[model samples]
Target chain A: MSLETPLHRVEGLGSSHSGVSHFWRERVSGAALIPLGIWFAVSILGLAGGHYVSVLTFFSRPLNGILMAAFVVISLYHLVLGLQMVIDDYVHSPGGKVVLMLAARAFALACGALSLYALLEIARVF
Target chain B: MADNPQRPGHRPRPLSPHLMHYRPTPTMISSITHRITGVGLGLGMAVLAWWLFAAARGPEPFALFLSLAITPLGQVILFGFAWALSYHLLAGIRHLVWDLGYGFDPRSANRWSLVIFTLSFLAPAGLFVLAYTGNGGYYL
Candidate 1:
């Protein structure tokens, strides 16, 4: 009385034949962002209106450098993944979706790389 | 009524239901805001990238970026970015909780939505007050 093939039943995959990797990754990143985001906000807010030396000195701190680099990488990755989901949801045309997805992904990667480079440069880690 | 030149056996794609017909609810608003804030944050990343690059570039570029960032229009943009960040963080937590199979009930979901909506505004405002009242004008 069932229509599903044996392979399908055994695989237990959805219509897209994919597991919950997307959902899991999004949630994991989201959770990580909470603490990291708070720290970032505090650091930046404190540095606001400060002199150039102050800003550089802040990043020169090893802990701040490490946290900032981590925050940048994770947040950009999360941003791209979330944008991918949103574009997939709303964009009707396959071509349009592909364009948006690639743009977002490339933007995220470029930003992430640039940010980490800046952090390393500030820390004088080369 | 079939056109002679039209392609045969093509099927129209299914569409998502229209949005206007449904009553607006907190859950719906939260869902929409989630997407909006995600976009806002995505856009804000450009500013962050620029700030970092300027810092790496040295004093003059950093000064340029800092001056632009402190202008009134820049402050407004920063406030909006901060609010978006706060809202997204709270809502993201709510989502993570839901993903764990809790808060699906109408009441809890609505409660979380309302809480997030209020705190998103208050958090940034509180930080502004704290920053300005402390020593120098550092309220971001």
Candidate 2:
């Protein structure tokens, strides 16, 4: 019943006549996050109360390192988008909202960079 | 009632549905709490990123983070973060379901709102229980 390709964003034919790009992208990233979130959560739980050696050894694996990097990237992408929407809806002051959005983006980027550095350092990829 | 001069509690109001004009339903509260928990999780990500960055720095820094993290305050914060992340995940799933054009009826929507809250709390509490009970000693 649809003519558009899977590549195209949906909801472009309504009365508003615009695509739901933000909503679409958010959902896509969120769908991807389910497994990543589960992996991180359960793995963290397993490491619970363990010592530094255990933690280091866990991250030393190449697969864990790669998954950690993927997790950080997707999470930061989702985080920035979610924060932008939150600020846009709630912040009444124009200038303040813009500043907050920029700050949120900066925070996500920082988190992403730090996470990658740590994972790579643990794996001795550098 | 506000549109009629003779009606009681009459007052001018915006044409659109104003937030203050309605009673707070579970769905409404859940919608807002989704954002609140989201912001909480965002802040929690700072802690996570710090943990990773510290680990990369050295064992000394890693131990320093652990020293602080095992403290009462830090444990509390971490617990809150866990709860917030679980809550957001459940809430996000609910939103995704709605996006797929299901659970739109008021009855189902409200039920889902409560379900999300209940499961969100329960899931983390269960995980924390298992986490803290490992090997009759510190598991982390």
Candidate 3:
């Protein structure tokens, strides 16, 4: 008896396919955000009442600085994805939705890049 | 009369379900809350990133941010943003728990959801009160 090959194997997978792409991306980003988010909350809490120099000193630590940069980038990317979904659901006009989603994504990337740059400067790595 | 009024050969039309007909489940409510908080966090994070950038720039920019933050309207917005941040963070951890193949039991899920919701709002509110009362510092 000959064994039947799995569907994907027989299909000879290439680079592209469709279905639930956005859903799973959001879920994975959501999962990563949990730990990144906890670290963020704790870090911010530690900075309570800290003045400018104090805050700078706190971020000057290499590990803390790196984590902050990662957290900001990841969180901002995740935020844009989540907001895009919300806009898609609520905004009925196609043109408006596309414009808004693009704007949201651009804003997120800009924020992420700026935050990362600031963290790097604080770390003296820039 | 058409032979295909309910013909097996014909494809069925898609029928969207009515929300009012079905009772909402714990999972459904939690999912909705997650999305709501997710959106809230999106806006909150934007503000936070802006705050950080301002601080990184110099005292002038930081003071500009602080002036807005110190205003009554700004205080309310900050409070709401904090609540959103806390809620989204807690709820997200709850989601991670579910993702790890635990907390699927209905009772536990419901209990945890309530716990997350309560703690999310209360923790931030408590801190805000403490700050406002000068127990921590003058946040207002």
Per-residue alpha-carbon lDDT of candidate 3 for residues B1-140, written as tens digits (9 for 90 to 100): 21325547878654555556578876677678788877777777678777777767877887788788878998899788777777777777777677779998998988887888789789888867666665552211
TM-score: which candidate is best? 1
Which CAPRI quality tier does the interface of model 1 achieve?
acceptable
Q: Give Cα distance to truth, residue A30, candidate 2, Å.
A: 0.4
Candidate with top lDDT is 1
TM-score of predicted structure 1: 0.87
Q: How large is the i-RMS for each model, in angstroms?
A: 2.9, 2.7, 4.1
Chain B TM (all candidates): 0.81, 0.82, 0.74
Alpha-carbon TM-score of each model against the true structure: 0.87, 0.84, 0.73
Which ranges of candidate 3 are over 4 A from the true structure? A1-24, A87-97, A124-126, B1-28, B129-140
lDDT by candidate, in order shown? 0.85, 0.82, 0.74
- Rate residue A92 of model 3 by lDDT: 85
Q: Stretches of candidate 1 above 4 Å error?
A: A1-12, B1-17, B135-140
Model 1, span A58-113: residue lDDT tens: 88889988999888889998998899888988898899998999899889988888
Put down candidate 3 lDDT per residue, A1-126, tens digits, no spaces: 535457655664433443466656867877777777767665665565546676677777888788888778778778887887789777988999999999998888887877876777767732
The parts of candidate 2 lying over 4 Å away from their true place are: A1-18, B1-17, B135-140
Better of 1 and 2 by lDDT: 1
Full-model lDDT, candidate 3: 0.74
- Listed per model, the TM-scores of chain A against the true chain A are 0.89, 0.80, 0.79
Residue-level lDDT tens digits of model 2 in A15-71? 435456777888999988888888878878877885787777778888877877887
